[model samples]
Target: MPYLLLIFVVLFYAGNILTGKAMNDLPPFTIAFFRLLVAFIFLLPIGIKSAWKARNTFREYKGPFLIMTLTGVTFFNTFIYGALQFTTASNVSVLETVIPVVTVVLSALIVKEKLPLIKWTGVALSFLGAVWVVMDGRLLELFSSSWNVGDVIMIGAISCWAIYSIVVKQYMHLFPAYGVLLVMTGMSVLILLPFVAVEWTIGSVPSLGEVKYWIGFLYLGVFPSVIALVFYNRAVERLGASQASVFLNFLPVVTMIGAYVWLGETIKLPEIAGAFIVIAGVILTTRAGTRKKRKSLNYKKTSYN
Candidate 1:
């Protein structure tokens, strides 16, 4: 059942790319702000009382919440939207597959989690696959010309997400999930206000009258922000973070298929091969970590006995 929820989670997230790419005409920051506004509104009725009661708790742990808001809510989707402006959504999703490997490295660096060598090799494989996708299967072209700015921006996006994941693992379990999301969404809306205002002032405004744009807006706000988050949290509770994250390896595959069918984006040979490699690497990395964790837990149980 948790795995089923996770499949939906990946699907909803893939929908984010498809919808966001479709509405690339809107200013990226503007899109982000509105998306958060919609999510805030949707979550308010359900989470407001809880959030109000936990206001002091949030303030007490303002540092982590602030970081979470900035990294996960504010800039991550903004970067994805911005990247879509310069590259295909498929490329964006492919690059995002590196997040798990990056998160593993960050885990080791920041939390001092000791990983075995095989996991490090998985990291290397994932990077190689990501590079292959980024260069569009033309490895030699990397030397001749600069990579797409969109791809570079995706690095920021993934880094923000990886950091956000680590922080959540470290601190967020103490808070009510929905309430925390509400507060963080509210925070993101405020943090993004200035940039959105700038976009408005500069006349990069969204077409408020367009039905398609509104559909995209609501889709982003509801699916990825609310529903997927709820389901993903539940899945994590059931499956554990590492196990749940392994499902994300399917993200690129889903996004590519969606991009092709919905947006008529070409599914090239390199993308296919690269996505396979990245998924293989991520599975290896995450499974290794999970196995090691299980071993440690077993060792602790033995000592206790």
Candidate 2:
């Protein structure tokens, strides 16, 4: 289980780095549209089978399914890719480490999941750590020239993903992950079609000759979109949402390493410190939830007796 989670982290991080690199050769929307289009194509058969077996359940979950598709597949991917065009991979990576914190808060509000004080404190610390990394510790200079439009877009992307995570946990009991993911990807592709058309009309289609771009696209579609989704849903099924979320802390670390290896980007001290703080905060928050769950179980048993 731990090894699978680690693979998920590595693949997702690689996906983000590939996404960042793709931005140099292809427009963000184009990449976002096609990556999902490919995912839809690839997963269509599985979705059909799941829907065939559980048609009634599919109808019942239509709303949540649409919401997940729109937020997770369409909005999240578009914003992240777009942000990559305007920001450094490091900035995008560091900013994204806050998703776990956002996921926890959203889960509490949406599903009435009880969070402990330690988790709340951890969320705060992790958030500050992400902000520190983004600001490079100059705190007050956050909105200065140092900040780019990409940073804002990435923040929005992170929020979308956080919401997606919460919604997935809330609805997983009502629908199978394969069905949910397929529907989400299908809807995202549909939503992106018009934009893709516009870009095509403008002659913005990516060149097939660019081997690197194709490799990135293939990696994004296969590992990050499809394989990662499977692993993530499985983890969520086994561990529950809050516990599963801890895996997200490794995203920036993997991304940083990928950037250094592939893009030859330098690793700075601030990024390392920020990553550590973020990981610590995630651990604290996750453990807090574990403690709360034990207490609740105990209370239930006592009340029943």
lDDT per model vs. reference? 0.80, 0.72
**Candidate 1 per-residue C-alpha lDDT over 2-22 given as tens digits, one digit per residue, 9 for 90 to 100:** 768988988999999889988
Screening candidate 2 with a backbone cut-off below 3 angstroms (N, C-alpha, C), the clashing residue pairs are none
Runs of candidate 2 with Cα error greater than 4 angstroms are 2-7, 45-47, 134-140, 143-146, 237-247, 294-305
Best by lDDT: 1
* lDDT (Cα, 0-100) at 71 in candidate 1: 88
Clashes of each: 0, 0
lDDT of 2: 0.72
Residue-level lDDT of model 2, residues 145-200, one tens digit each, is 56789878888887887777776766766766676667778778888989888877
Q: For each candidate in turn, give its C-alpha RMSD to the true structure in angstroms.
A: 2.9, 3.1
